[model samples]
Target: MELELKKLSPEDGRDVYDLLQALPADENGFMNPANGLSYDQYRDWLRFAAACLEQVGVVDGKVPETIFWLYEDGRPIGMGKVRHLMTEALLEKGGNIGYAILPSARGRGLGKKFLALLASESKQLHAGRLLLTIQNHNQPSIRVALANGGRIERVTADRHYIWIDP
Candidate 1:
């Protein structure tokens, strides 16, 4: 399948909205601010997300983030995020990259490709080694990280801190 990575933008349509809806809620730390939003509200959230990339209106304690969509054959099937700078809290948990494949798209080797795509995106942002905080129980992600040259750097009660060369 043809694969492409695209930056998040206001021009995204219902596909992105549907993808966000399919993803877990932000309370789960998935960066899905558009969950449960009305279509118009989701549109607004798109602009807000762009503003976040510019460090224009990020909330206090939140780092500026760049969002990208992983598309297969021209349709979005996964999303990823890269925080511009690092923070202690981030290193301890959130890390530099966060990604999720559409539930329907899981187990198809897309997660590995998506992580690789995010790593390249991070390099473009001039980030050094990449950090990925994976849930302890998520074996697929743990494997994905490792496949992308990630090494287990630390282990917390509920998370595995991994580092991958960019």
Candidate 2:
């Protein structure tokens, strides 16, 4: 199947919201509470995403983040995020890229493809290398990272830190 990565847009709110509905609340670290918002709220979140790319908005000292969605035949299948610049906190735990394929779409090697696409996108931003952190128990995600040229940099109690040259 053909796959493409598209930057998130306000118009994509409904599709993203629907995709979120099909996923468990806490399945993917990439998704936060705001992502589960209804269409209206999600549209606001999209605006927040755009503002993040433009470096706007703040909440309790946190900044907004850029988000992208994976599409197949025009339907949303997964989502990913690229922090414009990594903060110290991100470097320690968040990493540079975060992504999640819908539950129904798992086990098809799509995660690797998704990360590959995100890596290309990160390179465009002039980032020398991308950092990705996967939970220790998420073997599938670890495989995906490895398949995309990611090398383990370190491992913490709950996560694996990987670096991929973009």
In candidate 1, residue 59 scores what lDDT? Answer: 65
Worst 10 residues of 2 by lDDT: 56-65
lDDT score for candidate 1 against the true structure:
0.86
User: Which numbered prediction scores highest in lDDT against the true structure?
Assistant: 1
The alpha-carbon lDDT assigned to residue 47 of candidate 2 equals 75
Q: Pairing residues by index, what is the TM-score of model 1? A: 0.93
Tell me the lDDT of model 1 at 31: 66
Question: How does residue 102 of candidate 1 score in lDDT?
Answer: 89
* C-alpha TM-score for every candidate: 0.93, 0.88
Candidate 1 structure quality by residue, lDDT tens digits, 79-121: 8998877878888778889888988988999999999989988
* lDDT (C-alpha, whole model) for all candidates: 0.86, 0.78
For model 2, the local distance difference test gives 0.78
